[model samples]
Target: MNGVLKALALPVVLFTGWWVLSADSESFYAPPLSQILTAFGDTWTLEQLKADVLPSLLRLFAGFLLAALIGVAAGVAIGSSRRLRAVTEPVLEFFRAIPPPVLVPVIMLFAGIGDAMKVIVIVFGCVWPILLNTVEGVRAVDSVVLETARSYGVTGTARITRVILPSASPQIATGLRQALSIAIILMVISEMFAASNGLGFTIVQFQRSFAIPEMWSGIILLGLLGFGLSLLFRLAERRALRWYEGLRAAQRSS
Candidate 1:
């Protein structure tokens, strides 16, 4: 109850203040809070929301999941192999520096204006942070732990699955959290570029038609969608990092 109150109080206060002030504002930039809320409510008919939001969410998830799998795998390989790391580190850093939006036209050339291109762009944007973090996590694991596992005839798949990967999971979780944020950003960008049915497309459509309220609604919905996905990722991270929590507890006690 205390924690909940602490969390809710600031937002409640700020929102109420905004709604009250904006209720009387004459500036075109300052739409009434009620008007914004009403726009949000009216535009979000179940059918329309389902038609737009779901496609955007599906693309986000598909690309993010694929990136996580491949990134983690490649990160582990690179982290463990000096030669591979040497070969790929510069390339990874190079691509990571380039903005993902720039890849849209290049990806379009190869994949066209399709789901593949959207997913590809998302993966390109999201994977580097995750892959890099995974490498750091793997490399940072305690050498004693690695040697102890080796003493028990544990190496290869068993080493990774039972020891290295588990030890790296908290960092991986952190990376995934970052990746989720990037994924949402790229998802909207990709939709705006080439999509027919997503929140981004709707926002563009309403903007072009000069439907300001509806455009505001799409923007608000995108924010809510991003917030919801972030909350879910945080919850999953808490669950997945239980062992890491225990380790922290032990360290603090000592």
Candidate 2:
């Protein structure tokens, strides 16, 4: 309870400050927070959420899950083999150096301006962090642990599943956290281009139509969505890493 209050304290304070400061403001571009909140309530109805928000979320999860799967698999393979890592390092670096947004047009040419394109864009942006982190995590696994597992005849899939993946999960989680932010950013960016019905498209539409309050509301919704997803991710991470946390706690006590 205290932790939750502490976590919310800054946001509550900031929002209260905004409400007080913007109460008597006459700025068109920056309307009162009350007006924005009203618009948020009015604009984001169930139907609107179904039409715009749901699709975006579906694409986001799809891309993020695919990226996680591919990243972990490839990372494990590359990390397990020194020669493969050496050969692929330069290629990985080169691709990772290129900004994902720049590849939007190229991806569109191949994938068309559909949900597939948007999903691909998100995957492209998100995959690198997960892959790189997983690789590093795998490489950083204690050699002693590997030797012990080997001595126990934990070879092949058993070695990877029982020894490697668990050892590397912390770093993989770090990568996933990073990728999630990227996924959200890319999701919006992708929707902004050649899209018709999504949060990004609707936000752009509201902006172009001079619906300032509505646009502000959409922005707020996006922020809230990101926050909610992040909170959920942290919860899942804590659950997934309970064993790791316990180990660390034991070490500290010892």
Candidate 3:
């Protein structure tokens, strides 16, 4: 309860300030907070949610998941082999330097303005952080630990599951957290161009049509959605890294 309240304090204060500041605004572009909230409630119906919000969320999840899988897998391979890592480092850096949005047009040409294109854009944007972090994590694993695993006859899949993955999990979690925000940004950007059935598209539509309050509402929804996802990601990270946390606690106590 305390944590929830603390988390909400800033948003509550900001909302209160916004309400007071805009209470008497007469500008068409800057409607009162009350009007914006009213429009938010009125326009974002169940059907509208199904048509716009759900698809965007689905694409976000799909792209993020794909990025996570590929990043971790490739990171592990490259991290485990010095030759492979050396060979790929320049290529990885080159690709990572390119912005994800810039690739949308090229991806659209190949993927043809579909969900595939959006997901590809998101994955391209998100994968670099995760892959790089995971590589660093793997490389940072203690040599003694690797030797111990090897001595115990742990090889191949068993070694990865029992030794490598656990050791690098903390850094992997960090990468995932970073990638999630990137994924959300890419999701919206991908939807902005050549899209008709997403929250981003809806917001753009409202803006072009001069539905200011509705556009504001969509922006609010996006902020809330990002906040909610961050909260959920943190929860999952805590749960997944419980063992790592316990170890750190023990070390601190010592």
* Residue 28's lDDT in candidate 1: 56
TM-score of each: 0.94, 0.97, 0.97
Q: Kindly list the per-residue Cα lDDT of model 3 for residues 17-82, writing each as its tens digit.
A: 999999999999999999999999999999999999999999999999999999999999999999
Worst 10-residue lDDT window, candidate 1: 1-10
C-alpha lDDT score of every prediction, in listed order:
0.87, 0.95, 0.95
The list of candidate 2 runs beyond 4 A from truth reads 1-3
Error of 3 at 110 (Å): 0.7
Model 1 compared with the native: what TM-score? 0.94
| Collision count of model 1 | 0
Give lDDT tens digits, candidate 2, residues 42-83.
999999999999999999999999999999999999999999
List residue ranges in candidate 1 displaced over 4 A. 1-10
Backbone clash pairs for candidate 3 read none
Candidate 1's residue-wise lDDT over 148-224, tens digit each? 99999998899999998998888888888899999999999999886789888899998899777788778878877
